[model samples]
Target: MSEHEGTYRTFTGKTYSLYGINTGTNQYYKVIKKLADLFLQQCPDKKRLLFQIQKASVNRSFFKKRSGKNINHSLISFIKKTLRDSLSVYTAGVKHHLRTLPLSQRFDSTLMTKEEQYHLYMLEIELVNRIYKEPFKSSQYKFALLPHCLRDFRPDCHSVPGDVESVCKECTERCFIHLGSLLLKKYNIHPYISVTMDLEKLFKRLKAEHPSIGALGVACVPELVNGMRICINLDIPPVGVPLDANRCARWMKQACESSFNLKMLEALIK
Candidate 1:
């Protein structure tokens, strides 16, 4: 990890952006922003959004000294503008303040609360559903729809609902396929999608060009199997071309050794 560059920026810079991954840039961000906006549009009425963001609780020192300018400004401006009229532009792009909004600021790569993480996961699912037009209410179809999402393999549509492990594997396989479908539908060209960053010039120019809401994955490997198995292949340090990202061999092997620390802090003053 660079001592100077914050993890969030590093991660953002390093993160496998969906835009250039496959599909067109416009197609990519539109679908992501559309669903992300859906979750965030109704955010204000419920205190959950604010509380969730607060729960993330980023420290100021974590902000980078230099390059953190864009995202930091973007985030603050988003907060201010969203405060103004979170409801008005909920539908489509209608003078979103993203351009006028500060494009840079500084912050840490903080861990979002379970609620924030849950919303992220929800955004991920919505991304797939929006692109594929999958029925939002049912898991049965999503399980089957998963295979078609990934580009590489298309497992014959067969429902395995009983065994947890089999269901989990199927769910992962299908999600990847669906992601590919999303890109293809959006871009109309066979754009290469990967969990690795390979932007070249596309990554640098796009954010400045348009505004968007960030999301994790539905088509991503960190998928939900039978609505239970949350498989996240957390990586080690030194971001480079992933030889086998999903196969985070060391991370997977030491699963039990690694602790999942969750602290449930309740209101003291309230």
Candidate 2:
């Protein structure tokens, strides 16, 4: 396996690795871009496309009922079918993961069904990125919130509190957080380790401080999509790259080291 395809424990025994989804290539991102294009072709309106995807993610039967006169139900059904077949390989563990989910988190928005949380949310991130990438690039002030799991835990982390969240001290070159921070800073985007749990309050404060702000997120799929939605509602153009797997404590009994596609992050920002 490649460094990006290292074997790691998952919530479900089955792996949901995205490392080689495209067969013989590590660029699973191309698959995502292609699928996003297909979805976009079916629903040209970005906002409505996102809304319909989000709806399908939460409820599998969303496409079954008539949504509205303006909505194209037939095209929406086609998109749903394509997502199931194309995205299933990357979401193999979702069903088993949901079966073992804690009762307390059963109703959590992040713990939606396999199709909703895995397939639809994957498309949602791509769509959100397509819609917000240019605005995020042009904003006068830009910042990024990276998941703490991306930090190299072998050494004592030197991350310290920043104006918004904890900032990486770049103590270890092997850490993905350190590597991602370097690239983000090179593009004039401030990078912070996302330690805060109250995102809504944090975003509200940020909007007041930087009116022309844009936000970028590096998180697992469910959290990343929700964060993008929060930013959009607050008028902060947001872009994000999802972690390769959901190996955090919230998903697993103990947090395991995880990585995101660094190349994908640069692509979204640049």
Candidate 3:
């Protein structure tokens, strides 16, 4: 196996101050590859690696010829095995604690297809039943009734930037908790919630036009009132966000209720 060469250059002065083993040369690549394999195993969110299938598949950036004897191009292939390896350790440190949640999370219409919406509704009912009708661990624990927050209404659960399957099971739980609280308080019911109402795959359920499926996968759109802007990027994992002009335009027309027309919004796109 040929060794991979690594180089470094600073195009942007913004260097990540975080520290980790960088596979900056062929020797380190060999060790890094093995370490990365184990690193994936040790990583808490191994399932997240499923999101990196594309990164792994098109992993040829390491093999490109360099100009100098050791290496020519000053800039390193940021996408090489080194970054992925370090990312395993570096990525896992993020911690997200839900400050407040609303009752039954909602989604932008474009990101959500009619089918997914239907499924989630059904799931909500079933899970509520289990919480109320069939007593479970969650109910007896004494969950608080909390007011709706931005994170609660439109949650970027998976934290992936643009993948269609933006909903997270954890976020689903938050939705139910909100609904359960409302039901319990209003109706004096046992507070049961449904479990089944399956979650649909992001790509299959929605038309490819959803902007939430494009730049912001399940992103929390800022609610700007009185000239105050608050944008919260769950800042989870990065994922591929593919977009089409026509699809984007059609999506805005449907989702935003003519409030936004992507085609007409020239500055926004450019």
Candidate 4:
């Protein structure tokens, strides 16, 4: 892994923080890619493997059902063993976060995701990027949805409505949304500040307009995986970069500053 000093901050997450693994976030990406390559070697079918990983990651009951299969069992065991000491540091707060999660949000499956699921979700993102990167690049119309939380919290965001979501007005040079927007535009990818709650509806409408559409997302792990799944079901090739930490208001009492790996984002699209 590149030991180059990463721009990762020490910001903590209610459930996970990539910086927890090491001062730099590059190791997280490296580890996930290694694990993904190993898993793919066992099941050459990338789509089928992604499905199995996603299913096992979310429902413990479903995971148990597949335990009879050596591949399934080994995949879970391997991920748990391999990630426990490294990437698991990022998810160390998951148990506490789940215990203290408000009763009102108990039904929110994304908020209720366990530590192991977070680890699996990291692999899922890497796998999806590998599967869709080419299609996403060749897509006639490509766009990225950046979480609004990535905006500079120091100033009032000047984002305005766009064709599908809120558009960054470049109000602040230091804002991640602004910086990311600039990088994405270089690759002809439209970047929007994600504010829409009903992604299914929004994606459906967008798909109708751009049949060869591809999507890229920047969000927390669970949310990023969920969005990628939606795009897949809608026949939109998807790739994503998860936030370095889940420090938004949904995870904390108040939204705190958060960021994603800009270098990783460029690597995915470019």
**Best prediction by lDDT:** 4
lDDT by residue for model 2 (1-270), tens: 444344332322223556534432235577878988877776788888988777655554554464556556676678778877887777777777777777888887676546545777778898899899999999999999999876644458988898889998888776788888998999999999998899999999989999999999988877888899899999999999888777776666566787777777877887
For residues 129-216, what per-residue lDDT tens digits would candidate 1 score against the true structure? 3332312122121111122122233345342343211132233432433333343334222223333232223222322332221111
User: What does the lDDT come to for candidate 2?
Assistant: 0.78
Candidate 3 TM-score over all chains jointly? 0.16
lDDT of 3 by residue, 1-270 (tens): 311111121111011111223322223223334544543553323333322321232213433432224331221232233444443332221121011212232243322222222222212222222222222222222111111221232435332222322222333443423333343334332222222122223222332232222111111111110001011121111111011111112222222100111121121112
Better of 2 and 4 by lDDT: 4
Candidate 4 structure quality by residue, lDDT tens digits, 1-270 = 432234346767888988774766777788788878877887888988887777778577865776455446666566666766557777989999888888999999999998888888888899899999999999999999999888736567888898889899887776788889999999999999999899999999999999999999999999999999999999999999999999888788787999888889989988
- State the weakest 10-residue window (summed lDDT) of model 4: 1-10
Compared with the true structure, model 1 gives a TM-score of: 0.23
Cα RMSD (Å) between model 3 and the true structure? 23.5
Assess every candidate by TM-score.
0.23, 0.87, 0.16, 0.91
- lDDT per model, in order? 0.26, 0.78, 0.23, 0.85
Clash count, candidate 2: 0
Q: Which candidate leads in TM-score? A: 4
Give the Å error, residue 131, model 4: 0.4
Candidate 4 error regions (>4 Å): 1-8, 62-71, 152-155
TM-score order of candidates, best first? 4, 2, 1, 3
**Candidate 2 or 1, higher TM-score:** 2
Estimate the overall C-alpha local distance difference test score of candidate 1.
Answer: 0.26
Error of 3 at 140 (Å): 36
